[model samples]
Target: MDTNKVDNKGYLDMELLRFSTAGSVDDGKSTLIGRLLYDSKAIFQDQIEAIEKASAQKGDEHINLALLTDGLRAEREQGITIDVAYRYFSTPKRKFIIADTPGHIQYTRNMVTGASTSNLSIILVDSRNGIIEQTHRHTFIASLLQIPHVVVCINKMDLVDWSQEVFEKIKAEYSAFVSKLNIKDITFIPISALNGDNVVDRSENMPWYKGSTLLYHLETVHIGSDHNHIDCRFPVQYVIRPQSVEFHDYRGYAGRIAGGIFKKDDKIMALPSGFTSSIKSIDTFEGEIEQAFAPMSVTITLEDDIDISRGDMIVRENNVPKIGQDIELMICWLNETPLKLNGKYALMHTSRECRCIIKDVKYKININTLHRNEEDKNIGLNDIGRISVRTTTPLFYDTYRRNRNTGSLIIIDEQTNETVGAGMII
Candidate 1:
């Protein structure tokens, strides 16, 4: 057995997890976040001391863990999270990025923005309150965004005396509700974010619970397959022509690999043009690479001088994406004004950009119960709805369930120049 080779392979198997926290105000979201960071030893001593001093100045009896994530002046003064605060931390097993979003209903757009690219969503629920309408809304949004995993942290367990009965009751209630959702993986944990119980370390208080700590679960969750690895979709962002004396004939197509893997000498086709080409070499700032995968930005040189440019898609020859001008999408309205019926808008889908118009409002979803109301003509702010759109140019993409990077798009209001809605290809 080759021990050195085994060790080398093991080193490359480590995973990265991106998760976002969503909960109503006072759901102990900030405290749970602070606990995760503190217990993981990701926080610096100086930062802790600074928070402690601030806590004392505020006449707090104990250090307020929520203060660790409440960095904005408005949030501190108002005692509410306004904007999304992103935090990064890592352990020996995995790396993580936390998107802590505000809980207010008006900040639904912010939550969408934060969870759009997340692999998991940590929804905080107050143990005392059990489940509320806000919980349903957040979970629905998580399902709507197609987050792969969800961890329901039943916070403030200490306030409920760490009772096993209480935990089970809440878990059952949440489970029954989430059963209606499309979420595949759902786990519940009884935790006290303030006391750091069952967040990073196992809670001795809750002997009835047998699950791993939240940190352990997060670090161990399988996330490598969360990204699309079957369909090879690369949208050309730019044409790199380094017309220098050293490399006079250099012409490479620069873009990020949106899905699957790309290697040297693989056969690929340019969308809209249907031009066949073979990969000559895949180059990066670090030099040539033998292969590339989702999110890796590289310049690919082809064997043939095909006329490929921006707004074009490079995909596997056999695994071509759906190309069409009529798209059916599930859009989350972000603007206060009602969606202009059949109004023209600009659609941005990966590197392929085009103008689109809402063909018709299919139905509006009731977030609390996930019910579709076709009678409601009002698609106001914070409303999620299904609609059909007609684009000026055809877009080459896969369904959101197949490829998030290529399946999601944003609609801009031409008059206001503001992003009005975000859509997931159905």
Candidate 2:
């Protein structure tokens, strides 16, 4: 291997973990994120100076860490996060993307938006408050979204006198509640986000706790098996045909791998068309590769000239996705406008886009209580509900559990062109 090879291959190979921070009001979610950024030295001098000045203006004794993430003027003025704030940083071992979502009950849609792409979730709980309704709601959403890992940080441990008993009590309560949920791989840590205890470094104050620090756990968590790599699925987003004088015969289908793997000369079939073709070559900007896997973006060329376009799927013949016009999914209504019964909207799944009508509203999920409200068919803003829909054309999809990328879709308002809802096929 060349010692100083160019390109982002090394960075690409490094583990990239996207995690979301969620909690109720005053749970220190923003402060925790600020602490992580500050401890990791991911903050710039200007940013630190700006926050320091802001902190002084607010008459704080110490530099306010929460000022780092609460970037909006309104958020700072109100002292509350109102939207999904994204931050990026990297450790020596792994790169990280943090989605700092709003904790208010009305902003549940924002939490869903932030957690949708997260591999893990850091749910902050004030040690003084233990587990509350918001805690249950956040945990339920994490499980519903199928986050691979979860870390329940018992924050404000300093205020609690760093008591092991308090930590254990909260841990037991959280564990018992999650037992009723579909969540797996949960970890507990006692930390004072304000004091930087057991965040980036292990806390000397809590010597009773022997687990790894938050950063260490985040850096080393195994996420290799999180992606669906068994069933090959690719949705062609674009058809590239460079009509130039030099080598004008090139025809390639461009898309990101939604699932499984693909290689040169692999037998593949195009969905809706029922046409079969063999992969001639897999091309990328960096040169040809022997194989490509899930989440990778590459252009594929078929040996035979077949009619394939955007919304068309190229998948392994043996592992075909479900093809149908009717789909039942759990949708998180995103817009302020209530989801109209029998209303038609533009549904985009993978690269496929089609008009879909709401056929029936089965039930709405009460995120706080984790109960199904079968009697209520009205899904308003931030409501999670099970619904049935019919598409103008058949969709090729897998259940959300099987493939996150291929099994999810967005509902778009045709008139306003706004994304109104996000659905996970069940």
Candidate 3:
């Protein structure tokens, strides 16, 4: 049986796949998503009517599918995506969370945020325009974030009269450029998101093209090993202690597992304190589970009582994370105010918070070209750069490439209480 044809309802369990879409402006990103929703019967009748009425009011001949995702009034009026619009739908094989990111260069922060947790990236290229600078920028960002999969949707094939030559040229050009990137798995597909060709169903328009539809590719892509399951690291969020008579002795450390497999009777260590214990049981509301892994929220009881608290970490005794007060990271400045060398800010990593001082700005990156700019050290809004910082307390972390949850952080301004920058530990 083809699992993709199955109905995704309460009866059938499915894995959730998170993906983000990126492209240049007017490259049919929103329309592509609309087509996916419409053709898959993911949208409700009310939603279809709403967009239809909106299209009529805007004097559009056909229903403006873009209106489905361009939900903000400002975005609809301007015909541009500014903020990241998240959409949810499900096929029989999987549930999907789509982050429809903005296309403009200045909104790089938004794109980064949207793609940060995505397992795959769908980068649309206008068949008429070919590869543009925004294409380079978006692809580089996806590489930098270590996205596991990338599907280049060469869109608007209908405009080019479904020319295979144009598709081959664009694919060749893209292949040459992506050769310099760190992306491991990439696939190219010709599509016309507006006409619903090669989107939800294989396009009959292009007999020369042979590949799975975008939805089919998404449903079957191998994402089972995308998460780190070798190094065990769990940041303790809250300690549960119910002193009720029935459970008076209950003391469980609660957190979402950041990495690795943790099982009952597993030997574990608590960070900063360097205390060791053996796992007693992994508990959930339903019952006791024998094991837990990354991204799963569970309460764990240990055999030995350890002075574990929020900001502490539980890890496998043998494969632990780096502990230090000073580290280097690539930071994307998110605030209007430029970063100041030697300035103090509050840094949050995992469930830990500490004061940190900017030690030095190493270099800035020209995202499009991946070139380092050492001459100008000023890290401003949307600028990605390597910098060193010293934290007031030691942190337990891994390189961001190895573990996203344990290695990413946010810098907050003390006075303004605003998130000024996002960083990935190197």
Candidate 4:
């Protein structure tokens, strides 16, 4: 294979999509991923031979595709996934990143970590079991994380004789339940992962289904609108100063664009300081860029020499983020220890770090039932609830639904320095 030829043929320009899979035990989540990789020709021959040998050693009659994803020894012995396994593959049209998360209820925190940054989510449902508690749990998490796209792959269609009735029944049930959810985009497909039906290629057995296959949908889905381009948010991460004799006075603010488009000569405002400046130029390693947008990393030079440093945000004067010390948010406790009320923890936002105290626990949410427990203030591991926080410094943020990068934060235990909770500004 010619590496240079592949690189020059628009390989670096291809758009990347991150997706995650979730389901209950024996629901075929791992098998579906293996089939996707196999049918897409993403796996090598030696990997296939190794899985075949492992399957034979276990005395299985057929090769187990689930072994491709369940890489840990404990997972193989218990026949269940325990951690979040990430796999990468690419087709001619686009590149893909798959996060295979554990399905057990106790590992709910693992699923949250995997799906937090995903553009889409796949919730595998066993056709024999239909909609269950775990299905609701995963769906609710997908919604909480604001994953834009959802594909409910109803697996094991072969076991039900490829019946169209079973497919529609599950679809209808899911639709009725999800009507109350905040999910905007959802697609349902019936597939037998073990048989390679409707995963990558079109299924011959399911003639009644007229929709595109899973891979086709993933490649064609419109994700350009998933980002927040209306709000201008750029949190300064580093201040670059040159000590060279040729360009000794050059100073640039370096950070990833959190939102909106920033163009050369555009007027911008610095947060906390309230100083205004015009963009002198945008600097990138390749060359001076004319403009930059959300999620792009670039260094910007301002016309003024006003004092600026890390943790300060640059934004549009008219459309500024909310600046305050008190914030209300939905908190997901991640550690094994219970969250302490009125406890102080190290809080980190985009390019900013400070200390925050849990001022109040408003309510705890039951993910399975989508109910809020107003009376219970105690929050434990894998538990999600609404809480009010008071930070040491004013935080500039937008609602998580509007801007994920600016609205999300992590709380660390001050003594252990371990991350104990994650929050989304409500």
Candidate 5:
């Protein structure tokens, strides 16, 4: 059985794609999202009726499309997205999980959170506004997160009369800015989320435009190679021992493969203790499997009896990750309180856990302009910075750009237990 065929609702088969939307206030970010859902036939009848009624109540001639994604009561009232609201929709080609993020400067952390797990990022720019500060900031964040693909959506084309010059100007300005960043693939599209142009279907108005529709591009983009398939890194999350008489002798180390692929009979080594073993079998809740890949949780029985527990890593002999207590990281401060110069915090990386203390604050990065401020001592809310940390135990990891699942981590305050920061290993 192909487990990937089962949907969350168990009614359909769809391949899931996680994506994030980013733009400044009034850039039509929410409106674009609402348009996608509405035009794609993903919105419910009740939801549509409610929005229509609200539009009439507000004395608007047309229904407010932005209302569809502005879910919070405060957000709806303020006409802005304050937090990340995840929306689910599906097309025949694929299913989508959208992380609708806020665009306010104070909400940079929210955008980072939303984009962290996304395979692609849709950056909206107002055609009349061209490439502005917020556009630069969002694009920088997408680059910093190492998002695999970026689709620059020049929105509100109708506002600019669908002028080809307007689109070309914004495209040229954005292209220059993105050239400095480490973005992999970039595409530009002219769209009017309000008018349903170039969103789900081809636009008849823009005859000069010859690009795929936004939905078409998303469904066909190659993302199969986004995951690391060479370096095997599995951090054991739990030990599964079926006490039932039928499986009394079964002892399995369970975890989601963070990188690479694993198969039965492969030679593996458990880290920290340096014990060697071979995978006797791979098991899932459904049944045993011949092989498993990154992001899939499975249990492995070893041919040799080895002591492996939670927080330990199972890796291939030749492709082991860095083993060290000292690590350098590019961290984004997510809290309002300034990062303490020598503060101690709990670090959670994959299934491995440990406590780490900040050794130094290297530099703070200005996201909008890509400027590095080395003299800054404070890392307050929504600030991106580089810092060195010393952990109680060695962390087995790779650079975040190589394997997002294995290379990323979160830091929590010991007293409040609040996630204070998110970091990508350097």
Candidate 6:
């Protein structure tokens, strides 16, 4: 099993699970990721040597597995992850993309950025600490982002002598808090990432626990239903015109499928320009696929030569997304500057872009408490708020919970051209 030469076709056929790791500082977020990669033999010899040398320099008796993910120089020195670091690894069963997010309260925005696209989230809880505020904060963010599954990894069991009582207490408390959220699935696993207990291999120490290891659960979790396949949504990112002599008349609309199944000869409507056409062909580099679904990029040619371009969407005639200029949604303020209700910012959704003004500040949520605060209408950095946005053009969109690709948007500050906010439409 040469890892580098992992069967390309087999890997392509295997399911990909995008998961994010989150926890408070010193809670072994990076260590757990490294453990998964190491125990599964995903790292190369050079990587192992580099980790060993780095560990020895740090005067660590054990291999500093955290070094695998904390790649930044400042992060290595400060011993705190300051930014979202992405790591990719694969097993026989599934491919994985891990978003190792920061745990500090100030980096809530970074956590959101990391977890937004994740199908699952692994929140580490130090057994000694039980369930803490950061745990609540991360869970709330996970719920807000509509992450389908959560794994509460009660880490550092070695410090607590592998006590089942400690693990149960933390799990019970966290479950009670999560019941109020929209999270559909939750699993609790007790492990010591540093000691390599119950991360990849089953731990002999945890005979009392019968649950599968973290990697097993990750490989087997039901993610097929994670995508929204009911609503047909495709935002045209580009209009392709072939210049080659073989196909000079070729015209195809290019973009990733935002939602639902798009098949050949299906009746489609181009958005923002209400023209109707049937799909002539769904083209990919590997030839035309008979059908395409969410997350797959393809070029579609229409039977009728209806005018279509970037910022336009192709959707099924029925159950089309609502088109409107006034949109209300929950937004997380990401910039250092406070949100201005009067300010006009550039709003980008899918392949569409428009100038939008924050018409009104609805309310901000207290992340830890999961309660809405209306009196304090000010939305500052890292504050989660509901706001009214009036766009210059009508948007073909769905709620974030329904279609993440079409429902999520970013607000960019026009002056600095910086992304100021992230919004999930209600």
State which candidate has the highest TM-score.
4
Q: Summarize candidate 4's per-residue lDDT along 1-426 as a digit string, tens digits.
A: 222246568666778899998866578876788777876677889999999999999998888877887888998998777888899887767789998898777988888999899999999889998999999999999999999999999889999999999999999999999988889799999999888888887899999999978889998899998888889999999999989998799999999999999999999999989999999999999999999998899999999999999999999988899999999999999998889999999999999999999999999999899899999999999999999999999999999999999999999998999999989999
**TM-scores for candidates 1 onward, in order:** 0.92, 0.94, 0.95, 0.96, 0.94, 0.94
Error of 4 at 358 (Å): 0.5
- Model 5's alpha-carbon lDDT is 0.88
lDDT for each residue of candidate 5 in 1-426, tens digit (9 for 90 to 100): 222344544536456799999766577776778777766677889998999998898787877877777877898888777888899887766889999888777899999999998999999888888888899899989988999999999988998888999999999989998999889999999999877899987888899999988989998999888888889989999999889999988899998988889999999999988889899999987888999998788899999888899999999988889989899999999987878988999999988778999999999988878899999868999999999999999998898888888779999999999999999998
lDDT at residue 282 of model 4 (Cα atoms): 93
Question: Where does candidate 5 stray beyond 4 Å?
Answer: 1-13, 55-61
lDDT of 6 by residue, 192-237 (tens): 9988888888998889999999989999999988888989999999
Ranking by lDDT: 4, 3, 2, 6, 5, 1
lDDT of 1: 0.87
Output the lDDT of residue 104, model 5: 73
Over 4 Å off, model 6: 1-12, 51-63
Error of 1 at 181 (Å): 1.8
What local lDDT score does residue 341 receive in model 6, on the 0 to 100 scale?
A: 80
TM-score of 3: 0.95
Clashing pairs in 3: none
Give all candidate RMSDs, comma-separated.
3.9, 3.0, 2.3, 1.9, 3.2, 2.0
Q: Lowest lDDT 10-mer window, candidate 5?
A: 1-10
lDDT of 1 by residue, 1-426 (tens): 122244556535556789999876578776777777766677889999988998898888978766777898887787677778888776667778999898677888889989998999999888898888889988988998889999999888899888999989998999888888788788888888888888888898998899988989998887877888889999999999877998798888999999999999999999989999999999988889999998788999999999999989999889999999999999999888889888899999999778998999989988877789999957888888999999999999889877899999999999889999999999
Q: Score each candidate by Cα lDDT.
A: 0.87, 0.90, 0.90, 0.90, 0.88, 0.89
Q: For residues 64-120, what per-residue lDDT tens digits would candidate 2 score against the true structure? A: 777787888998998777788889887666889999888777999999999999999
Candidate 2 residue runs with Cα over 4 Å from true position = 1-13, 58-62
Model 3: lDDT to the true structure: 0.90
Better-scoring candidate (TM-score), 4 or 6:
4
Once fitted onto the true fold, the runs of candidate 1 whose alpha carbons sit more than 4 angstroms away are 1-15, 49-62
How well does candidate 1 match the true structure in TM-score terms? 0.92
